[model samples]
Target: FGTDTANQVEEALKSFKQANVQTLVLDLRDNGGGYLTAATDILDLFFSSDEVIYQMKEKNSAAKKYYASTDSKYEFVNGYILVNGNTASASELTAGALQSEKGYQLVGTTTYGKGSAQTQKTLSDGSVLKYTYAKWMIPNGTCINGKGLTPDIEVENVSLDGISTKDVKETLKVDCVNTRIKSMQKMLNILGYSADREDGYFSVATQDALKKFEADNDLTVDGEYSQNDKQMMIARMMIYINNHENDKQYEYLMKIIK
Candidate 1:
């Protein structure tokens, strides 16, 4: 959320209204969250002035309830929020509020589970300190600090889900045993190649899968995973996800909407 995000959402809602779009799917995947006021502003679009958006509990102070102050511009008969493990803070707040108050269903995976509010202060020594001072909760008064909001409909995107590739340092070949090999094996298996195992060991089957991928992509027929091969695999995986050829979560959402 930013200063302009609410404005953009308002404009989008206006367009949707003009187009007679009655249902809404708010995609909040990988949103790490931002300003609280921005979130409240966006929530104001879907809630009335008397509705409580969220509650804040600061140290040694009574919990304060924040209410929406504006009328909703558009009312959807059905609404869903698409979230993932990376959705945090204000994103969780918005999702939780809508889910609790408006009966909106949350689709996709669990959220990132960050419910604290933080502030920063500059000291006299020219240093800055940032720290969490308060906790926020949904309208039900349940704080989702460590436990993320569970999805009403759980859906996993298996084709694009895998271990991180940041620690892949060296070239991987048959007989290599490391996390990189495991990550590569998982990717290859998800991409429809038979890597046989994903236990961090690069077997002959893994080598063969690599070779097949290389041959299919017009690369050298080497049964090894180099940095270039990793890059190519990531690019291809991105294209696959971007094309949405097999988005199970989205498919389920469409089915439910129909």
Candidate 2:
């Protein structure tokens, strides 16, 4: 979902060496684990004497923890990582290593709680199970198998206004979100929303169309559309569409698209 690993890590360290950095936050919300060897090499940058960072055990096989010979080069003034229930596998491994082992503080919510390790193997049935065959444990010997590590600090936008979709004038990332406006227009046309175009460009007519869509869905009458506002509105339409077309072969696929 981002730049290549080598580039991202190098850029991070370069940014780190820039100034007196306090409270660095590494976000791994939608990150999926890649090459184990790559993960091992990256972990070496954060540890002393290239010791074992993590042990990946799978199936009835012998388990092994990776070790690096190189010493740690950069230490954080304040290291913080963000993980959500979406975080999985090697992401959890890195977080657990830095936290329970290397002592990097964790923020945000708990992890996905998927502790069992899986290696790719073709099954006898010619299908892939990606089965979990072994458990991964942190250096502190805490096995986060099935139960994720809870965040030290839980930040909730507890304001009722936070949940309220009404009165939002605009989104923060407006330029990057105009493509969504096009999608809204397409969906609006499918549902009889009036608009002159579906070109994926934001225009006054598109904003008005969104306002009408919001009003139809009982969303706040705000003229400017936020990502959530659009998403919630789409989700409602999709649910209605699904309910009516539940018998369609593509109905489940529609849900997946959503």
Which 10-residue window in model 2 sums to the lowest lDDT? 156-165
Model 2: per-residue Cα lDDT over 1-258, one tens digit each: 222674568578868779766555676654665554555566677777746677766668766665665875567766666666777767877788788766676665678776676567888989976755678776556778788877665533111111222333556232334445565566666566675576666667766777788787777766566766767765765565556363232333234334
- Residues 1-258 of candidate 1 have per-residue lDDT tens digits of 998999999999999989999899998988999999889999999889888999999999988998899876468889999888998999999999999999999999999899999999999999999999999999889899999899999998763455555744677888889887888888888788889999989999999999999999888889988887888888777777776567777878989999
Give the TM-score comparing model 1 with the true structure, all chains together: 0.94
Model 1 residue 203 CA deviation (Å) reads 0.7
Candidate 2: clashing pairs of residues: 50-68
Largest TM-score belongs to which candidate?
1
Q: C-alpha displacement of 93 in model 1, angstroms?
A: 0.6
CA lDDT, candidate 2, residue 16: 73
Model 1 pairs whose backbones collide: none
Candidate topping lDDT? 1
As a TM-score, model 2 comes out at 0.55
Worst lDDT window (10 residues) for model 1? 159-168
Off by over 4 Å in 1: 159-170
| lDDT agreement with native, every candidate | 0.88, 0.63
